[model samples]
Target: MTSQHAILTAEAHRDLTIRTERAAALGDAAMCCITVPDEFRAVQSEYPILFRLSDTRDRFTALAMFGFENGENLFLEDGRWDARYRPLAIEIQPFLIGGSPTDDGIGQVHIDLSSPRIDQGGQGERLFDTMGRPTPYLDRVAGLLGTLDQGYRAAPDFFAALQRHDLLEPFTLDVTLDDGSRNQLVGFHIIAEDRLATLDAGMLAELNAAGHLLPIYMAIASLEQFGELVGRRNRRIAHGRG
Candidate 1:
């Protein structure tokens, strides 16, 4: 569906109430989300970090994997996301940082009118109070958006560093379920531990000085979550829900 994005404003959305819940109906069943280096530490703890080329194939994006296939979010169960930390990209739903028309130094917040999170029945948290000031919920959302924007701006440098070091390599995952079913995941990239190991002390120091080493390690550590994720998918298959 085409998105209907409109600049958010208290005057236009004073009564808008956003439903803060995790459910498939609210568009929370994605298998992966675009991630940024700023949130890698938080995201790596809960999800496997992977990489893929952008649609234009001119840039790379980090991804937090939640499941093996499209529309299959294993973290989402029983109306909740069973994780300690969610990627900022997923948390900032229905709202996004949009470009300012006047080339001002400020970012504009835009809302997707087609989102199911829009609760016009007044059953959710209001975006603005009666006085037209942002409520605590909206304030929190704004903060999330701000962080996301910063993360996006910092991503290119991180990807470029990975490329310069030749640390990214294509990988394929083959999974076998208890039911004897096989699944293959292809066309994704991950930090090549072998290549990373080959980096000299000087290269390592350069990455560390640039604040890229920690996140690179975090992404590598996140591979351990793949076992847990596959277990979730296995359990779902056993329950007849996979």
Candidate 2:
């Protein structure tokens, strides 16, 4: 089979399913729960981009999340994160669920396109052209998020093994913004400890060569705007309770 076919076959083996109800709840709630290794706590704590919520007594569950608004502005506010980083106006929403061995003992992370309010008129058309028709990249990203959930569920032990060995793999997901811009979200960059250090140097070099990283950075920067809005809602709720 061709390389693309092989990849699709492998992905098919996972049997992923997107839980729309759960995803919608998360968007309405505007939150996510991420579990990381205990050893990464200090790194996470120091990372201004991520916010830590709580940790399990065993220290295995380092619960934290990234505010959509914070994610939106991450790049623009600080171009240093990625030198090629630029600022864009897009929207991203994430949701997560966790459980133990019976349920695979692994937590699932899901991301959705809550909104993509771009001012440009041709944004969608541009993205469609870049990705090609039928199963566009935006839909594929959403599908992958669900697939990620299945992967986590199917092999929690394997995930832990990767974590123990410090051998996480990097992957990319593409999203089409409201403005017709296409955004790529790079994954498995372990926050402050490595940032982009662990990424494939060749890929980074290629991106640099192609000069497309800045726009991606800007797209991610757009997430911070969403994060801020969630923060505001949270604060209002807290104040009301107080």
Best by TM-score: 1
- Which candidate should be chosen as best, given lDDT against the real structure? 1
Return the lDDT, model 1, position 51: 96
Q: What is the lDDT of residue 25 in candidate 2?
A: 21
Q: Give residue 188's lDDT in candidate 1 (0 to 100).
A: 94
Which segments of model 2 are wrong by more than 4 Å?
Answer: 1-74, 77-134, 154-242
List model 1 lDDT by residue over 141-163, tens digit each.
99999998888877788999999
Candidate 2 per-residue lDDT over residues 46-164, each given as its tens digit: 22122221234221222233323322322221212221211110121222233443564534433222332211323232122322332354355445444445533433442343344
For every model shown, the clashing-pair count is: 0, 23
